[model samples]
Target: MLGKLFLLSLVCFFSLNFLSTINAETNLIADEIQSLKVTNKDPRMINFSVSLTEDHNYTSARLFYFLPNPSLNKSATRGDLNGIQSKFNNFYVDFDTNKGITGSRFIPTGVTFEYYWEFTDVNKNNYKTEMQQYLFLDGQYEWKLLTADNIFFYYYGNYNKNIQNCFLESVSVVKDGSDLLAIKVSYPINIIYYLSPSDSRYAKPTRSIVMDSMTVLGGVKYTSNVVHSYDQDCGVVKHEVTHILNEIAGHGTLLKLPFWVDEGFATYMMNKSDYYDNIIEKMINKNTVIRLSSMQGKPGTPEKVNLYYAQSYATTKYMIEQYGLEKYRSFFKILKEDFVIDEALQTVYGHDQDSLYLEWRQHKGLPIIKLVKIEQSSIPIPVATITPLNFPSKTTVNQQEVENNFSKQNNSNELAVSNFEIFINNYIFIIVGAILLLIMIKISIFLWKK
Candidate 1:
């Protein structure tokens, strides 16, 4: 019987173990991912697709992607892939640039995005493809790359003499700017040049922002670290690249310098033409040139726009030429430390914005008008101390009351202790009497037996 019971126990153990193993087992299968492709329909749309070696139904399919640079977060942006029936059994999705995900957003053309695809099978097992990178480009033109140092120039259409000159000069401008600012170009600055002016319509749409009562467009600095240009001049490249270098060097948690300092420095570095030099002088004579402090944005009228740019150029030129590049470098460093523009100027040049403006005007042979400082009157605000009503206060007892309560608790405890002692004494007395009775009965039984 013992042997049969032991055998029965062994059989139950084996059966239970086998069932647990089956429950824990999983089916592992690898899907063959092949022919991954990204097709640019235009700047307005993109198509992404991938093919499978064996046609197997997946419960879910998705594409995950993100731009590594720019302000776009590093976290992946998810895009769902169309069903297997679409595009002849290929997993497919069309990304509309003007609608849905990409939209008319500030996502710059020519920037690269890293992407990968994920698929979940019927059993809920997930499979992910290896990561890949694709550059978003203008599909309207065949692009040719011209790379120098850390600058990547993407130009399209037949190379004209202007294009050649701009490309070569851009290389020199980028190198010189990087050296002058003492900033290492860790990431590539992509310059996408639409050779024909008509091609601008097909290129990525530049978003417009209203500034200073004017809709400002046509600026290449719309996207960070990327330039979309139609100009054939090397000055355009220099001007735009100076903005990029400035951002790379001095931008900290504070994203930008003042508009005048930023735009003026770019114009001065461009060395484009003598046109800006005379525009400011004419505006000064007409007493129409806006103050540098007030020209914090691009102005409304065309004439004011011209004056704004020229004044910025003139002021920045005065700063660098008068105080020297080292002082300007120090000023940039102070700005990087998140100092306000006026404070940075004061720290570096021992002057404020208005003072710099007057100094620049005096140097330009323009009238130096003393700006009236607006002192804001400090108004004392009346503060009300609100005391809440109807709330119960903590209950307080007198010293005599506390003593009386303590005495009562002591009396109760003494009564309980005395009752417990009396019960214990009675129990002992009863137990001793029973023992004596049992001893006498045992003696009587012994005597009778004897």
Candidate 2:
């Protein structure tokens, strides 16, 4: 009887052990992520899925990702799939740009986003898929590509080499300006050309703002279709591009730049023939030029608008020529770092805006006049015509000042005439020579590359 009882106990113990082993094996049967597929549902979102085979007991799972937008983020982006749905035996998540899932603000187009999925099973097995990449775009418009080395110029509509070349030419000037300002650009220079005013995505806003052109994210958007003529495109093309470069050098922040500094800096970079130079000269002769200090914000009165732009340009030119670019660059960086214009000026030039204005005016040979301190947002509009103020009238133009102005203008006119005469005299030969020179240079470059 005792032996039989012992055998029964052994059988019971073995049965219990076997049951425990089966329970452990059942618990070990957790889901393994077989595959991951990512897709863009919209310009801003990434829809993804994970395939699981065998045991599908994933009690908890999530995705870890980041935009390798030229580079990966220092921290990985993660999303919990606890409440997210799974379909067709696959789990998914949408890393949204608008929703700040792909880091903070909206992820700009033409940038690649990278991500990966991380999932956990009931058995504590954490599965991670490989990183994936995606480019965000609206996919609604056709595009063209124009390249000059590293500069990428994208345009819509028919290809015009002249228009593209204008942009390429502007690119060199822009870089030169950046160098002058002691600014740096690490990324590739990317620009977009909008052939027509209505063709741009920001067309309505562009029109509403009364601007001939605008730029965003280093892309130049202009109105109407034409290869920019030399003198004509300065107001639109180089002006907008200068603004873009300033934004770029400052890392896309121009909040601290004063209204004149911003606009004037653009004009300075272009350094083309001024649109209002004649008008400005006339105003100066009439002693009607607006005080440089009055150019706060973008004043909109028709009469003073050109005057404001002129002062801005003159002030900027003064800074560039008289103050030296090194000091201007330091000031540019200070403003870029978000210091107020007055503080930046004081730090860099040892003076405030008023003092700078006074100096700039003196440099331009304008008579000293007391200027009212107008609130930035409350700039008084000049009525119908700009009235001359606080100066000797044309009849009172002292002989010395007139002689000085006349001598300067006469010398400039003579120099311009002499250069033009030479050009006209050798016109046909000059063109032929230029063409041959360009061809030779191109051949040399081709051979060097080979």
Candidate 3:
């Protein structure tokens, strides 16, 4: 009976030892799966592993991958105390017999992100990790990726490929009296230009125009597309930089000034000689001259648009010439303070709106027409009258009276007739005397000759 009891106890000891070995093996597998390794191929796929442990709080976890083309993808797996989440079916045992899993995510070409691993074991332990990578187009032109402290600036395309060379040629970042500003040629991005599909009207309308040249936007960078034609004259980087300064000085408000003023300021900073000439020519040609009032908002019509941009350039030039740079700088401050166009102008220039308009008009050689009224009820008229009288009753008149009347009438008629007769007689006498003188002279001459 003692031998039987000993054999039973030994069997129990062996069973307990076998169970402890299995538990130790499971714990060793869990402890070995401490970290995950991630690898990215050219097209972007993610592979990683998660260690399962007890005492973690979360039962499942997710991993996110960012693509370059504005999209993201995620993979999720369940957590296990001794086994990985069942969702990761491809999971297998590593060389050391730890849990291993691999999966892929299709993200946009340029997508980027920071990732944190979120999971809770039976013991409530959490984990997070950050990763970085960039997706580039597959072509002959390879881009040098740049990232500084989580901020990234991607350079692509021909110009972008030679960014360092271009930067050497055109860019300058200067520190001036506690201020920093970078002057650089900003190449255009075709994608950004086409990004605002809804605002196509404001974008380049024709392939021809798009081919002509790229334009600067938001005063921050220059933009161009592959189809742009006028590439050589894109040296307006300084002009845009000045606008950035002006915008900042104005507290990031354009103050609803006319487009002319806005552009004029930019052009003025670019150097106004050429712009001034153009504006003067336009003014002389009676092209649209933007009024301050008219330039208070976005230019709507084609005529106004031309005027807005041209006049903006012109007026900004005028301001520089008349007000000086210091005053021009102060004008922005005034605008920021008042936020009223007319009031700002008056405060800065010491002139009212109408007066300013008159000045601008005069400068442009435009005539101002004013309405006037006249009154016409103050003239006097001259008067004249004639009266008819009946002949006096002759029957009762005495003969002497009748004779006197007839004699007076006859005397008046005879006076008139005598002046006529005298004139005729004088005329006849003068002719007769002249004829007699001629006859006597002829007779005397003839007698002498004989």
Candidate 4:
């Protein structure tokens, strides 16, 4: 009986010790942090405030935050709170969203951040408050959310047909794209659509032109599975969501997939309209279809932009139709393996860019224009070297004349590009002049009416 009593006492002693250890750890944070609050001061700033318990005195404090990316990983951002304030057992730190004390990367509005506060006591013991989530917004509008198929659409004002269509179409695109590409979208994608173009200050700002005193932003996708747009067009949603899928497929690869492949795939997924079809047909007739090598980047001029998208769509369409989507999928897989466009084409389609272009043209039943066989080099200079090749067409064209005409065409293209650059360089002056002209016209019309 005495032995049993001693064992019971021993058990009670260890249980008390264990309970005390847990209670001490739990109180460490609770005792230091009395209350915590985060406020979105405006579109450009956020204020963090924390009150500590009277028992503990702290000499140092820090705010740590995290921004999650699509790869299921997070980046940590820290701010020193020592100098900001520490009176009445309270601490305050104001973080500038634009400057992003974290780094040079810009953190746009509407992104959710997880943050916590850590305090160092005079005894050098560190205590951290519980993590909390804060949604960064402009705090100027009341927003509403609609969820469908892992997509969250946030908007303000009345729920109109346009928003409904955007929501439904975005859901369909996500489903179809995920199944087609075998990509599982495990996380929710947040899309913030501004109901009024006037409210664009709250949306992600881009380098955009102001036309007719309104901002035009089709759509933009960020690496964190966040999308921002001002329009409710279903086509724009399809295009942007396709880019999200493309990003998922190529995630973790060092080199980015070429612009042609990326944008072309997005365009193809959109299911082109009659206007796009007309553009492709017209470019084919002019024999000005941009070569694959020339399609390394996006075009500058509006006309070239139209031609670029049209031709890219046509090229991607031909590949999927002629060879089959499964083969195209294999090609995409190769591209994800860090192979360049030329090598990926060669491996999957058994041809290079030149041959693929030739075959696509043949598929279109267009007149065969012989492309100069330029020697491949480590660094591709835009200079095209001409080499004569036998043509399948029975009609003989003057080789010398063709070369000379090609040279003139290249020169004319360069001149047009240069002129466009000059126009773009004077963009600010042109905008100011156009605005002045509009104001003058308005005043004249008012006087005439009077």
For each candidate, what is the lDDT? 0.59, 0.48, 0.36, 0.61
Per-model tally of clashing residue pairs: 0, 1, 32, 0
How well is each residue in 1-450 modelled by candidate 1, as lDDT tens digits? 565555555555555544543343232233566588889867766788877665556666666554454532232122233334354336876765533222233345676767777766666555667778999888777889988877788887787787777777777777887766676677677888776445755453432222211321232643445676654556666677777777666664634566677677777777754767777667778877667668644444333456667778888888888989889888888877767677788899999888888787777677557798634222322211110000011221000000001001121121212334434642664555555555655555555555
TM of each candidate vs. truth: 0.70, 0.52, 0.41, 0.70
Runs off by more than 4 Å, candidate 2: 1-86, 89-108, 111-133, 142-144, 147-150, 156-158, 202-237, 247-255, 282-308, 333-340, 346-350, 362-367, 372-450
Q: What TM-score does model 2 achieve against the real structure?
A: 0.52
lDDT per residue as tens, model 3, 355-424: 6656766776777733232221222222110000001122110000000010011111212123344446
Give me the displacement of residue 420 in model 1, in angstroms: 70
lDDT of 1: 0.59
The positional error of residue 339 in candidate 2, measured at the CA in angstroms, is 5.3
lDDT of 2 by residue, 201-288 (tens): 4211111122222111112221111111112242345555565456544421325345577667766665554544665577778877
- Candidate 4 lDDT by residue in tens digits, 128-175: 778788877666667788998789888888998998988887888888
lDDT of 1 at 222: 35
The candidate 2 region of ten consecutive residues with least summed lDDT is 398-407
Q: C-alpha displacement of 62 in model 4, angstroms?
A: 1.4
| lDDT score, candidate 1, position 202 | 48
